[model samples]
Target: MDLWVAGVDGCKAGWIAVFRNLKDPAATRLHVFAEFPDLLKFDPPAQVIAVDMPIGLPERVGAGGRAPEKSVRPLLGQRQSSVFSVPSRAAVYTEDYRDACEISLKTSEPPRKISKQAFYLFPKIREIDAVMHPDMESRVFEVHPELAFWRLNGEAEMSLPKKIKGRANAPGLNQRRDLLVSYGFDQAFLDQKPPRGAGRDDLLDAAANSLIAGRIQFGEAEPFPKSFTRDVRGLRIAIWA
Candidate 1:
């Protein structure tokens, strides 16, 4: 049986997904979706999906971000900053940045404020939140690309970043690409221009995530926090890599 799986990442268009067959690494599809749910409707159906987005949002956050973020940060070392703090559900749902920060301060312990960068992700976060149901947790999972790369690099942090100074760095990207190539992905395919609305790095990120999806399917991938936690909505609040 050829089961399909997807690795998804948020992109300018909405989401960039790399769907691959568990049995055939060469059989893959790269696409940019207009919405998160559209990935759900993918052809041949993705039995497993690992996405680079926050899954569970707590009503009150502690000193670090979610347990998952805190749990995985130590593993990434200098690369840890790639993991952003996910605020409370109330803050995420709030419209204005100022109002959101106000709500977050009240909801979080030690009074954390939302960063503009994290605040900007609210729309995409809400997009996934609105459509996510607890039942889908069986197939859908949360992932972090940098964390995935860390695991790929023998549990060590990547010396190069995918970007530097807001610009794509070839050496950093090729370092990641080399890792995926070692895992059996074709370099040329990964090197191809990403579909409109997504960057090449987005393509590579999605590809890394797809490999994790396969691991999750085979019970090979491990969850951060080493334990599962759920939110008010019953969504699991953990990052898998």
Candidate 2:
């Protein structure tokens, strides 16, 4: 029996999902979902799903976002900038960016406001947050692509980045692509142009998440903070790789 697993990444169109058979890494399929719930309801359900999005919502944020984000940043080296400081739950729930920033400043210990990058992700973050709960840990896990790459690269951070000044960096992308190839993914499949509404980076990121999904399914991956925390909503606040 081929148990399926998926690695999902949020994109402008929606979510880019990469599904693969756990027993056969070469067997893969890519799909884009306009909504988060639809991804869960995908045909041939994935037994485990590792997504590159925040899963927990903390009521009061500490200095570097949550424990998971804080823990993973040190391991990412230069890529640490890719990890944004998540705001408090009240801030994340706000509709206006300014209001969200105000709430975050009031709720955080050091009075930090979320970045524009993080603000842009609020909708997708809320989208997934709305459907996730504590019990879903068995079937769904939070993953970070950089952290996954760190694990794949013998615990060393990648020297290049996926983007440089908002543009895709070919060398950096190839560096990641090479890692995926070495991880047993089919190059041809990975090389396929991303489906409409998604970017090349989105496809690669979803592919990276797939590896983490397999790791979580097999108990090969560990959460950033060995001791995980829970949000006010009981959702587990941890990043796995």
Candidate 3:
């Protein structure tokens, strides 16, 4: 009985889908959240939780300047802050939490009461925080050294265009997102659905990135950041086991 947990981060809320047994497509659960409670109820055994968010920041965020090289801005335009700079493209859609951060600048818009930070990372931070709770902590980090590697080295595999880096993933972009979602399913069940569109597709891509991280941590693949740890914008998964 393998367990796979997948999540998609939308503008205002997120949609989480859980699948068991890669062989059985029908055995899946999808949860939509407007708030944090939606993620609380179930605690499956031996599950891999994948998330989309920046897990680390530039050295400026901390006292010591010990961030990794990969997270550093390119040498050409290095002055920009290394902290997860909000994607300007995502700002156009005011509904997405990522876009909500930039919503305050519109001259015609009236000031909203929500905190911008909360607009982006609220219940998410809470959900992760809850994992630290005594009851849930054991279920999460007991046997996850791979995830520990991610915390120590936080950069997406697709740091730059594949052309520049000369690194590309298999199944290509066409089925990448679906493959990611499918990763959450048990090894027996596999899916190859193509992403429907550009926007939601990004969500799927993020999910896949989480899956990639999980694979590395689980010893299914080689672990990256061989020598040191750096931070990037994404979720953090930690397990002691």
> For every model shown, what is its TM-score relative to the native structure?
0.97, 0.98, 0.41
Computed on alpha carbons, the lDDT of every model, listed in order, comes to 0.92, 0.91, 0.35
True lDDT of residue 209, candidate 3:
37
Q: Which stretches of candidate 1 lie over 4 Å from their true place?
A: none
Candidate 3, residues 68-178: lDDT per residue as tens digits?
Answer: 223333321322232233222123224656344444333113322334543455444444443444344222321111222233234223222212232333343334433
What 10-residue stretch in candidate 3 is worst by lDDT?
Answer: 137-146
* Model 3 misplaced stretches (Cα beyond 4 Å): 7-11, 18-29, 35-37, 43-46, 54-119, 130-199, 206-210, 213-217, 221-241
Where does candidate 2 stray beyond 4 Å? Answer: none
lDDT score of residue 164 within candidate 2: 93
Model 1: per-residue Cα lDDT at residue 84: 89
Winning model by lDDT? 1
Sequence-dependent TM-score of model 3: 0.41
